[model samples]
Target chain A: MDSKKGMKRREFLKKAGVTAVAASTAFAAPNVHAKTKTYKWKMVTTWPPHFPVLGEGADDLAKWITEMSDGRLKVSVYGAGELVPAMQAFDAVSQGMVEMGHASSYYWAGKSPATQFFSAVPFGMNAQQLNSWIYQGGGQALWDELYAQFNLKPFLSGNTGVQMGGWFNKEIKSLDDIKGLKMRIPGLGGKVIAKAGGTVVLSAGGEVYTNLERGVIDATEWVGPYHDYKMGFYKVAKFYYYPGWHEAGSSTELFVNKSKFESLPADLKAIVESACARANISMLTHFESQNNKYLQKLVNEHHVKLKKFPDDVIEKFRTLSAEVIGEIVEKDPMSKKVYESYSAFKKDITQWAKLSEATFYDMNK
Target chain B: MDSKKGMKRREFLKKAGVTAVAASTAFAAPNVHAKTKTYKWKMVTTWPPHFPVLGEGADDLAKWITEMSDGRLKVSVYGAGELVPAMQAFDAVSQGMVEMGHASSYYWAGKSPATQFFSAVPFGMNAQQLNSWIYQGGGQALWDELYAQFNLKPFLSGNTGVQMGGWFNKEIKSLDDIKGLKMRIPGLGGKVIAKAGGTVVLSAGGEVYTNLERGVIDATEWVGPYHDYKMGFYKVAKFYYYPGWHEAGSSTELFVNKSKFESLPADLKAIVESACARANISMLTHFESQNNKYLQKLVNEHHVKLKKFPDDVIEKFRTLSAEVIGEIVEKDPMSKKVYESYSAFKKDITQWAKLSEATFYDMNK
Candidate 1:
């Protein structure tokens, strides 16, 4: 390196004389290759634009990819409804309405029901453990296998870290208080809530605030403290709870149409994958970091009282969630296959986390 | 707390009747209360794990310390060789020589220098830019950061990334000539030599290869595949080379000393950071996922001609590498910052690396 050699590599280049733009530009720019190629792709998203974390994550992905490839591959990212209502992104991408999509699999439960296992399951894997299950533990390969049936190659693109329980219109005093509450819940948690005697509804972020404000829904969970505060849910409901069990560690994805994806040249394909990989890690920490600042603002600035869900309520949800998950296993073959593997891995990882992470966390200095 | 709602937060545990863990085994459970505990600390790193990415990264005041206690505490990690032999890790922890040590930092860049930057700096970035610059510019914080740092805290850890073209052995090739030149390489890309020009030497996979291989370091650069490979150069050299600059995105990290880390209250130290954010994109993937496969078959299944460097050969290395990079920077500060930032961070990171890491890897990535 620079430590030993007498002459610098940059100096050697100065003597030879090449330019900076050349350095930043893709090496293959103005390709002298006999054949020139360009790729045009459409990407649909689950989040709206410039919404900071989630939405911006998608926009940034598209922008960076275009720049990196030097216009060889062009991708236009359409926000939630710009392509399809946010929840519909999965099917649209799967059906090849677009070349790609940025979405959370939990939103597609109505389509396959089994897809929720990939995104999150109540009492499921945490982000790290989930990632391990997916990437290192045959989850991604199986996900690919499942999506292939739908003409899709799914990539884990984003994560919401562990989410917060929804904002509620009334105090969730006890397990018996949930009679006919309508909550915007999705994925496995929705089923668990339904089991716990709440009417589960599904809607996008842009709609949640209005619904909660209008009393159309008594409660709603939309990401974490940062976005929830932004949506002003605290103004409508003060009972914000901890431990989001529904979509814990929710992951977003760039679901590429298999046909279109299979056709790209090697370099461009690599570019797409790398870009998404960056997004995946970036999205998680982005939320974790930003949410801390925003949560303080929510309580200190907005006067939202943070409260833990009463134990009986949580206990009931846990019990019902377990039953709901079991029922899911009895109903879906894919779910069963996934759960079997998922739970097996979860057990192994839980043992480590309990011993390593749990112990350290419990005994304070 | 898991205790029932009727119980007070403190006595809540007894009321719940859940068994309490004995003090001797306390470092293994999750904390129930958050945000009000202080943690004293020590963290050991692999960078000597003493400095920079290997040490400093581990040592940077715990980001969570402020958030957890509303700003009452901080913990630090030490570098390798600070308390024990760079390689004698099992003994160090078992004996509690230090609370924790930074993770791998190249599984002990002492074990192998060529792979030291697996955490960072081939043609890497300065520290600040690494924290933000490289990641947004297509370098995710965790790419090889944690895996190369230790095995945990991927994003929290960082490598300088590809180092400068390392010191070398005799060289000079039409680029294709670096066949059968035995050199020590660490991490994954050490596996990619056919294109760059070299026959890699694989020993027990540690830092020792750098100097010991000096008699054999034909024209080595381990990091830039350029620099690190250079560091492992052949002894009594004839030709020197350039390029290996591709690892401009390498990283390094501070492995937190484990016990010190464990002693922190929940939230006071969230060791898991925002770094693990995932993306749907992939990169150098062809090399990572595909070419690696072919390169293997060629090297193993078919046994293509493996090579070493020849002097007329490195003449080209010294030539094209400069041409390739100078063309990259030309005169732009953005390019310069990109370059300067990487260089600067590398310099700062190295200060610590030199005392701890350099001593280890220089002797041992």
Candidate 2:
């Protein structure tokens, strides 16, 4: 490729400056600090330290940056309750209490309702479609614009593909089965479940297993098979339902303090950005692999009954999902704007998906 | 986050080395040449220069590396037939004639039949499943083992997620409709089509458009909407099919000369790997957006008849796909080993995908 034609005029100037730097090395001493600067950063996450996949992703990102930058940058990751409370991750990053944060965007829905779109929506984009939308469609721009108000720069770090619906102590054969059911669910899903006459209870991860086991909560949706299996939910819940409509494809993000991110050198900035992308791919693959492995173990070894949410119940949830989404859009102007962009992207991408991914899977199955 | 607990012993050594280097700056004047060193490398790709998404991905990878390394690594890309023919990319990189090569693994099937599994297989894994397998399910380790035999290191750099079946001159109503049909298709897909009584012909990309128009080939399977729309296939082929079973999710890879890769400094090596990961995410997202956009254009403006292959026809192809795959395994021991790994991964991932992606789509649709 012709360097002149390939590079823009501004890039040409940058290249020329680099060439001059190479020439100047023959005479002058190097800037030692610039050449081997070490940056120590603190990253706060929502998951416990060393937790599988999700927490491991945070550690992987830190390790990758440290190794990739040749120790120029080191990130120390703190789990929930380590440096800050789990729910306070967003506040920590936004307030610059930490240099970085590893958390799902929806955790900050109270701060900005639009934040939910960046995480997942009920009956919305799946993992692949989410990646396509955020990276290629206009999702990232809108995300950046929305988060700028909070003084945070966000990057897509990891994804928990499509989460399972939930685990139930009894069969959910009809819409009537959902009524008055105390289920541990959260986000828009909880809202939809509540609208469907089910009692939605907010439960911590640690409390979820016992609540479901003791009939305190009749059902609970933790992640997919991998984490759920580790939590031993299958031992108590006989009916494991799937097609998590609430958090279809939950996207986790890396939140950087805008000013701190801007202060990094060009190389370090790229390192951070690329490391996020690597972790994004890595984490999802890890979840998919582990979930598949443990899912088999749950069914074959543990005798967990794999069940799909009945058609009528799914239909009810779908209808409620649409209504709940509409209500979310009407809450505020930012929600409306983000919802509009999101819905438009979802609609367009879904058309292609229906004709492509949906068809492929249907044919193969 | 406790650094003592988080950092491994090996990492501690690396960090200690950096700390010493930082301290030594007080005594040494400078290592000016090391600080300003630049690496100029050449990359050869299968697509023509500046070709949409595929070729652009190569250019993007090069640009990302250069910028990420702060001009420490500058890559010049040569498109098909510029430095070598399109099909010679693997050989060029393997022989160290080019430092890097951008191409799909399936093109090297003739060199090593096992290479086909790395690209796409008929009735095989979709892009998301492919990513999970390659990145998490030991696919990359096998890939490294396979490529190491040729002295090359491979990185999955791009993906065309769920390509369309093909463009047919006339409607395909049933299995009988495929009989004696001359089609421009290649790879294992071509073998499957031939087995189903269609006449498969090898044709170059530039020749495909004219060949289909002139009745030299009754149909052709180019990429999805964006490329097909640009190729003006709708002018001749009335039937545009859905769900490309042949190449379900085609993976494009970057091949680096193993010794050349080993020579890079720690940071530069990280820059290369991370830049490739960035390009992998970027290219797929680009394809998804452009394909979504152009698919609408093809249907609304160009009046392309979007059709799904009949269920019976799909079943026939599916049966033949299994047979073809078996024959492939029987060809060699390595092929058998790789096929075993791929099929096992496919089976495992498919279970999770069905419970998650499939169920979600079915409920919504």
Candidate 3:
């Protein structure tokens, strides 16, 4: 695994503006009293090294923490497979193998079904409502309670605001079109497709492009136009769909080892939390700003047909999504508890949104 | 003005975990090297003391900076009229009479017409789109350049997401209904009212309710449900309107004296900026989380009639808004430059929004 080069004590002292006299005297004696101790942390993320906005957000989060702490706390970031595989990030941080990990919470559904609600849900609240529920409503307390069981503390770090549905090889004119289709989709979305009589295939990020190109998969759900354009999905797929119902405004997380985090000095702790908040807004805005340009290219340059799922088809998926979530909640008590709060907050916020955001969009049009 | 209680040196040292021996040695000589110098600053804001989310957000921003800096920087927040009148916030921070100021940008239109674009505009972008343009697009650089001319550095600090239009005693059925109406609106919205052949009356936050009740003004616009409910506008007006086309997703700002900000140590500077970002999201989420409950109260408990402006009337406002903005750009070169960037970004993001956010809202419904 690649590691960041360590900052020398002399260089650190110089950069931190410690006087030579103070430094020399502190080092002169074995039991010399010195300034506060410095902490060096390792953060492992699920994205490939320097991958688009997701991985880049992780790097920026680390940098902001270090900068805000004035070198008193330094963090080195590792991408997927560098320190551990992408799927292993949860355990790496939970087991205290790494100080922190960055990934979507749904990735840890195997650890706890309740975790998926913290990431995204089919027909879930959008980014603003989700953030409001998590940060201001009781969502954070529930998230904390859930993660504490696994010895982790989670922070809402970034968001992919209202992701596109996916790249489709054919138009989804009705529910019948979903039958017998072989598609690569993951998480609850995959289950919904399965319920609709489709064969769900699994493909890694690097392999999805080749799978679609070679007809190994009839369709694939990736990120929106920005990342999809980079994946060259438009080159392989004939049509793209709108309103990612399966993963609306999916939130990304930074999960740190609870013990390691608690051991931090108050300033470093405050600095870390604030840095995550900054990263959250920074990443969402970054995506919103660039997605349009890339979307334009996908439509105008690549001749990809942009299509909306049929209203009836979307209604079917909505019903299937409810059934999928209902079954999970029926089986898992924690999922029930989390989903109760999630659904309640979603209901109230959606009403407000209808009058506010929804009306604003409709009026402008 | 109330000030934050100072942290005693001994308490600060104990809290920061400075070794007793080091403290003794540092205090032994008058010329002893200290850990770092502390900064105590005053921040004047444009809201009443502890006014719901807006004023409370300023308090939180100061606390975060102090916590992150570990007592190296302590900021005292003063409400409007405590240090200076609400409208004088710009001059206070710009002239360095105060280290910082918090208010909406449009409050400074007399100082520069271009400043209004940074806050909100009639039928302009929403919160997500505005943030996209300002933070990631080239809007920040232009803002920095504009604020630099006034010796201030500004940060987009908070947002009131998709505000409510206003409370009206008379229903607005068409463009003719707006004529001869006296409304307590401000800035560009007031200008639009004037263009619609209405009389625009000026009233402070504290007087809006009384004005509407006494028929001094026939209508008034406050913030969204959370604040408006507290203001008891429902008790005074019969019809409440929706889709605040005038100030949709209005952004608030924190302006710091450029020279004072530059003088801060690197860590303190980073701490302050991150604190503002944390405050930005915190306030927006706070509003989003609570507005729905209060909105339900207004509609159900008090029977406030929630109304949407008629489509034709809204269209007329849109036309007039364009003309008003056209006059501004014609008169001011800075407004032209900023509006060019703002309008272009708005056009592109609005297109993307149609496919993403707008579609997501529609599909869910």
**Mind giving the per-residue lDDT tens digits that candidate 3 earns over A176-221?**
9899989999999999999999999998888999999999999998
A160-241: candidate 2 lDDT, tens digit per residue: 9899988998888888888999999888889999999999999877788888878999999888999888888988889899
Standalone chain B TM-score for every prediction: 0.42, 0.90, 0.91
User: Higher lDDT: candidate 2 or 3?
Assistant: 3
B1-365: candidate 1 lDDT, tens digit per residue: 11232134225434544332121122111221221233344555444542322243344334322222222243454455666664665335434554444454445434333223334433343222344333443333433342233332223344332233343444344555456665555433343443365666554324445444445444444432212222333333333333333343444433444444455443323322321112111111111122223323433544433343343443454354444345445743333334444444444433322222122212110
lDDT of each: 0.53, 0.84, 0.87
**Residues A27-114 of candidate 1: C-alpha lDDT, one tens digit per residue:** 2212212112455678888778666688888887787566545454668988878768777777787787778888777677777767
Q: How good is model 3 by TM-score?
A: 0.92
How large is the interface RMSD of candidate 1?
A: 28.5
Model 3 achieves a DockQ score of: 0.44
State the weakest 10-residue window (summed lDDT) of model 1 chain A: A27-36
**How does residue B190 of candidate 1 score in lDDT?**
48
> Looking at model 2 chain A, which ten-residue stretch has the lowest summed lDDT?
A21-30
